[model samples]
Target: MLEVRDLVVNYGEAAALRGVDMTVRSGETVSLIGANGAGKSTLVKALMGMQPVTSGSVLLDGEDISRRQASDRPKLGMAIVPEGRRLFKDMSVKDNLRLGLHDAAARRRGADGLDLAYDLFPILRKRSRQLCGTMSGGEQQMVALGRALVSRPRLLILDEPSLGLAPIVVAQVFEVIEAVVAQDVTVLLAEQNMHRALSLSDRGYVLADGSVVLEGTGTELLQSDRVRTAYLGES
Candidate 1:
């Protein structure tokens, strides 16, 4: 459903991504795993049109959207739960989620989208009026996920969804993601938690120093000597 070809991005003279190529098939969950400086987030930002692409093409359902504005991405069936959650801390939970429906078509289906989110995280319904900043980190993360899901995107991109949460909360978040996958939404997960990410993925890509170092099915990757040594801390 999404294809990235020869994708490159630079911050002035320093390249953050170099000729990266990857694809996410319809209704599949793909994981991008790497260390802190591996450019996983950069690639995610580029895909969402939040970062400037130096040279490359991003295609969604065969349409080149590399030049589309960030605001236009959601309307074209793309949504992201960005790194750090990036929620409106001062806004009410419901208001924050409502922002996801800015697109006219999504707005028309807003009620259903909201229902899906509330169903996925029932606590959200109870805390709809609370200020996001006051919620615990796990609750805040739930809000972020709900906001992205509320758009009913075809391709859902989650960047570092497990970052900064307790282990139990991380497990819960992944469970929610699993439910999302069951519903047929194509997911591109950029995560540092290799084991969890690959375990849930249908396919996985290993990024290193701005390029794809390895790509394979999830179980294949998990058992790889290289992956075990590099990311999994095995000898």
Candidate 2:
């Protein structure tokens, strides 16, 4: 459903991505796994057009969208839940979800956006009128995912939803992800936690030094010696 070819991204004199190539199929959860500074986020930023692509192409449904503006991505059925759960802290939970639906056309197609989002995170429904900043970390992450879902995106790009949460909460978030995939929304997951990510994804790509070092089915990577030491921390 999405294709990124030889994507290169730079920040002034520094290169964040170098000739990176990746793809995510419809109904598949593809993961980009790497340590910090590996350029996984840079690849995402470039795809969303938040970061400029020095050279390469990003395609959505066979159409080149490498140069499109970030603001246009949401209308094209693409949305990202950034790493930090960047919610409008002072705003009510309902308003945060409303921000996800950017286009009038998309909004008109659905009156149940809030209902569906709340259903995805029952906790959000219970706390819909509360200030986002006052919620616990897990609750805040739920709000983030709920907000993203309100957009009715065909492809949801989530950057580290499990960051800084308890293991149980992380598992809960992944359960939501698995359920979302069942609803047929394609997912691109960028995660630092290799085991959690690989378990959830059908396929994955490992990046190092701003380039793709490996790509394989999740099970394959999990069992490989290279990934075991470098990522999985196994013997």
Candidate 3:
């Protein structure tokens, strides 16, 4: 559903992504696993049109959207739960979810989007009017996911969804992700936590020094000596 070709992104003279290439097939979850500075976020940002790509193309369903505005991408069926769960703390949970419907196509989905989000995370429906800032980390993450899902996006991009949660909370979040993938939404997950990311994905890519160093099926990478040594901390 998404294809990134010879993607290059830079901040001044510092390269954030150096000729990275990757693809996410429709109805499949693909993972990009790497260390803190390995350019995973850069790739996500570029694909979302939030970051300027120096030279490359971001194609969604075979059309080049590299030059499109960030706001435009969501309308084209892309939604992201950004790395930090950048929620509107002062707003109510339902309000945050409402913001996701800014796109015309998403707006057309109307109440169905809200129903889908609340269905995916029932806690969101229970706390519809609650302030986001007062929620727990896991609950806040649910709100973040709810916000994105309310857009009725075909492609869901989650950036480090497990970043600051407890082990139990992380497990809960992964369970929700599993449920989401089961709904037939294509997903591109960028995460530092190799095991969980690969475990949930169909295929995985290892990014290093601003480029893809390895690519394979999830189980293949899980059993790889290089992936184990580098990301999984195994022998």
Best by TM-score: 3
For model 2 the local lDDT of residue 44 reads 81
For candidate 2, write residues 1-235 as lDDT tens digits: 8999998888899989999999999889899999888998888888888988899899999999999898889878888999898899999998898887768755864467888888878888888899999998777877888778886888999987888888888887788777777777889999988888898789999999899999999989888899999888888
**Between candidates 1 and 3, the lDDT winner:** 1
lDDT (tens digit, per residue) of candidate 3 on 1-235:
8999999999999999999989999989999999999999989999999999899899999999998999898888899999989999999999999988986788885558899889888889999999999998888988888888887888999999999888998988888888888888899999988999999889999999999999999999999999999888898
> Relative to the unseen true structure, what is the Cα RMSD of model 2?
1.4
* Count of clashing pairs, candidate 2: 0
Cα lDDT, all candidates: 0.92, 0.86, 0.91
Pick by lDDT: 1 or 2, better one: 1
Best-matching candidate per lDDT? 1
Per model, state how many residue pairs clash: 0, 0, 0
What pairs collide in candidate 2? none
Each prediction's RMSD over C-alphas, in Å, is 1.2, 1.4, 1.0
Candidate 3, position 115, lDDT? 91
Lowest-sum lDDT 10-residue window in model 1: 102-111
